[model samples]
Target: MSETNSQQNINTAVTLLERYAEGKRNFSEANLGNADLQGVDLKGSDFSYADLNEANLNGANLRGCDLSFANLSQANLQDADLRGALLFSADLRQADLKGAKLEKADCDRSTHFPQDFDPAQVGLQIKDG
Candidate 1:
């Protein structure tokens, strides 16, 4: 998708999130590529199938969030909390996960980990790839 269209989708998503009253906000299938989402309280939100490639999520609170099938290639997730989050079939190729917490995050073989990360150091149990 073009950059302009992607930016518009991101703007719409942000507006929806801000106007959300109760219940978990569903941002599934939204194109949010290259958007800045730093320090947002997105806990328990549904981001399934969202295009978040190259987006910045530094220090974001994403605990218990559903990120299944999301395209997060090259995204910045530094210091983000992903405890108990679902990342099934998510694309994380080349994404920066420095100092991020991934405790109990459910990932499949298709999920890519950072090259610089040592599984033991981050307490991640690598399943079949």
Candidate 2:
């Protein structure tokens, strides 16, 4: 995507998130496909069931964010901090999670990880709970 387009997308996402925080708008299942949200501070944001397919989330600080059931297929999440984030049932197929931090992230059967990914490399420990 072009620089202008990327900026526009980021602006739109920020606006939407601000609206959601203030209760001015509701994006319960909004489609944010292919948006560039790199380096954004979206901590504690609610993105449950949102369509985030192919979104660029590199270096984003998403600690404690709610992403339950969100579609994150092919999303760029490299080096993103997702500690304590709620990612239950989130679709992560083909997503680039290289060097991402997922400590304490909620994962289940529906959560998808790359085929050759080492959970320990990303600080993820699969426990039998």
Per-residue lDDT over 73-125 for candidate 1, one digit per residue giving the tens place of the 0 to 100 score: 99999999988888888888888998889888778776766676664466554
Candidate 1 residue spans exceeding 4 A from truth: 1-13, 19-24, 125-129
Residue 45's lDDT within candidate 1 is: 77
The C-alpha TM-scores of every prediction are: 0.79, 0.77
The list of candidate 2 runs beyond 4 A from truth reads 1-11, 20-27, 125-129
Residue 115, candidate 2: alpha-carbon lDDT? 82
Error of 2 at 95 (Å): 0.6
**lDDT on C-alpha atoms for all candidate structures:** 0.77, 0.75
